[model samples]
Target: MRRIRIKLNRIPSLPERRRVGRKIMADLGIKLQMGWNPFTENIAPKAYALMFETLDKFLAVKTKDNRPDTVRGYTSYVKLFKKWLLEHGFDETSYVCSFTESDAIDFMDDRDLAVSARTFNNSILFFRVLFNWMIERKYIKDNPFMAVKRKPKRLTQKIRRLFTPEEFNELIIWLEANNVPYLVMALMCYCCFIRPKELSMLRCRDIDLDNQLIRISASIAKNEKDYTRTIPDSMMKYVRKLDLSNPGHYLFGDHPMYDFSPGTKKASSRRFASYWSYVVRPALGFPKELQFYSLKDTGITNMVNSGVPLTSVQQQADHSSLAITSIYIGKTDRASEALKAVDIID
Candidate 1:
């Protein structure tokens, strides 16, 4: 099997881009035979069709949160995986139940694609989930991904992404100037130190503006336990000004500014990284690697630096283990307090 890396030449203007795209598609044909999947016993065409249809049905019916956009993304990922698998000589007709841990590991290692470890991990996890679902539903007798542990490399880069005072001010000004909502959707996770996924299921009614508190139901929180975080007094005015007439409306409702629908909101986490790249970073002149999750990191850092108790931040951050919070706090000047018996040699 031949491995080819796709290279994008410098992007031309929109008109030029459209012309290039059309020409490329024309050259490739509407549906050309890429490779054959032996599992279907048919040529490439039937196997590819079956793979897509299977993925669509699985995502649409299996996901706990059945948002349209979420399903759409899973469909796209599965398609990309199928393309990769075929090009790499993976059989499609034999149930994925025949696969093993080594197969999975080799697949990741052998790929010429220059993707991140996190992305590779996600692809493996997606396959794991897919196989698990298939096994449970009797589509297959066993799950191939059960013992396939994804041992990802340690994240060496200390995540240094947060809005400085100047950057934050620029973000606000840009939003206001463009009539975008000033409510920092990303900041809710950071300032309150909640998980990004939890923010998605939040409803307008969950917030108590009068009491300056936001309650997250146990059902939606990452820890699966009910917890409430108080909205700081400083942010109350911003909360008060928000329109919350629709009880069913999400806190991050489908605002025109964000171009989000309920479908978009469910898939927001997947899109959050891209949002910062195309919109937030460019508008604020920040680095390309800056992600929305960095907002949470900054929030935790500021809270710790300002002498907030680690225990309190842990609870707010919904960390199951105190050790995790300690890692985030790192070594602090307050370490002296813990070292009561330190002796200095002359």
Candidate 2:
């Protein structure tokens, strides 16, 4: 028998002790079903903390290094998950520990039925990573999303597109003639082949017109590797237009009254989404399908077609391989096509 100690309001008589033992025995079956060892564990009361608190703790540690946009995505996903848990009664004291792959699928099916393949895959990644972390620290016994299948991108609701010359010219004209502050950002995306996330982490110090280079340090780069993007001489006229006096300020941010402003801090890539929705999308009358990133596509396509070396475009794109760059080149719009054409964003 195992030695155990119990504290009570008063010394219990033998009859009272036996009565309490019976109650404990009855609860043990339920505890076992919940993945808790009632005899050896008493952690549910403090650890679960009514579910949401526990989830918040996980997020605090897990998303600390994620980009602002990614953090927001994770937070929103968690909120929806928590609401689902409350509705489905998964918020019980030890229900989190009891979660299995079946429950994970149920949540995905119920919440992600109509989401895009990218969104569905990202959600699966989030849950798998979240649960793996939990399992590592003994918070749970298994990863609930370990076996979930990814939705095929081809089958998902994707709005694939390429910018026609007419559309591209119209957009540039609109930017030059209005207060589209993201014009410079769009130019960087198109000209220098930089991603919005990378641009968000950029400071004035990174843009060196004198050297015709933009530096991406490993800390800020998505690939965790240092990269240098050349500032084409043709684009220098536009690059020179930026206010680089304050080397510490973010390159594409610092709108004085903007909600997504990263003033004195790193801005979020999410600002691009809001800017596109509230500003550019309405002004240009562009559909949701024509993403700002499509500018990068136009640039890559223009370069490869204009006889720029495959390896050269690959390096400029910071792509891991030529294969990926080739894929971008494969989806070109000749009418809206190259270097002379892109001449554009972040």
Candidate 3:
């Protein structure tokens, strides 16, 4: 029998201390015989896994359970931290409790983590999550990243304005003339209001031309939930041009340039951005603020301006609430024209 005697002073206000004890006791399945001894006869200290061993265990739990993209992201963060750990001469056999708040701060301040505010913030969040997982399993007493501050994160890329009709038409003409591979993909981003990542995961089978609905799979979806997006009436003629007869084939994927054939393999989600950055942006002399994602904004604006119901817009965008749809709706293009009728300062 293992006996633990702790006179925890001011435990009423020290909820963290109480929480730690509760977590460890619950995780080890130790029903306290004495009501004070958290470590029951079941738990063996010798059987406890080391730091590296725990990492392997964490990965084992995630590899089969989590999404591939999620797993990859977590793995990359681990690799970076592992590299930092190795550089600082951290022993792989050290217990999770060996890591301190200062150590976490140093890791956060590491030059490699200075990529962007979002990346740095995400790294902190990842560590917080990892340490919390460790704490739950009785590997650590506290989360080190809890002391590490997150930098202000603004998604600069996503803060986009709507595209003008003139620029939009010009780009389409250029795309058609140049026989660009991203032609269909670019149109889908606007017409279907699909994000690049979502479009990259699209298969011919996912699209129902008969019903004019496109199914967003749970695996590749941003929200990790299944969604159905409508193909607007105007887009039907354009969508029908594609050979979506091959149910197994990718709608916009690895295929010959200008061929517009169903591809056997999935294409990179970054292709749209790549083309916009190198080809389209340069040729059109578009400003830095005019990103490729602006099409989704522009399209949504047009849909609302054309008298599409707000509820329908909310559903089509796959937003959780109508408020999010309203945020994107912003000041519509026709708002200026409509405001002209109302004379101010009468």
Q: How much does candidate 1 score in TM-score?
A: 0.61
Compared with the true structure, the alpha-carbon lDDT of candidate 3 equals: 0.72
- Kindly report which residue pairs in candidate 1 clash with one another: 39-93, 39-94, 40-93
The positional error of residue 272 in candidate 3, measured at the CA in angstroms, is 3.6
Candidate 3 clashes between residue pairs 3 or more apart in a chain or in different chains: none
Model 3: residues with Cα > 4 Å off, grouped in runs:
1-49, 111-113, 153-159, 224-226, 256-260, 332-335, 344-346
Candidate 1, after superposition: displacement of residue 300 in Å?
0.9
Order of candidate numbers by TM-score, starting with the best? 3, 2, 1
Q: What local lDDT does model 2 show for residue 326?
A: 85
Scored by TM-score, the top model is: 3
lDDT of each: 0.60, 0.72, 0.72
lDDT of 2 by residue, 1-346 (tens): 7643432223247775566455545656677788975467643322222346557878898577777567887788889888888787665343354566787889898756667678888888888887776766656655769778888767665574768878888988887666434666777788789888888889888888789999999888888799999888877776676667788887767564443322356656787767777888788899888888888888888788777899999999988888898886546644443455785576
Output the better candidate (1/2) by TM-score: 2
TM of each candidate vs. truth:
0.61, 0.74, 0.78
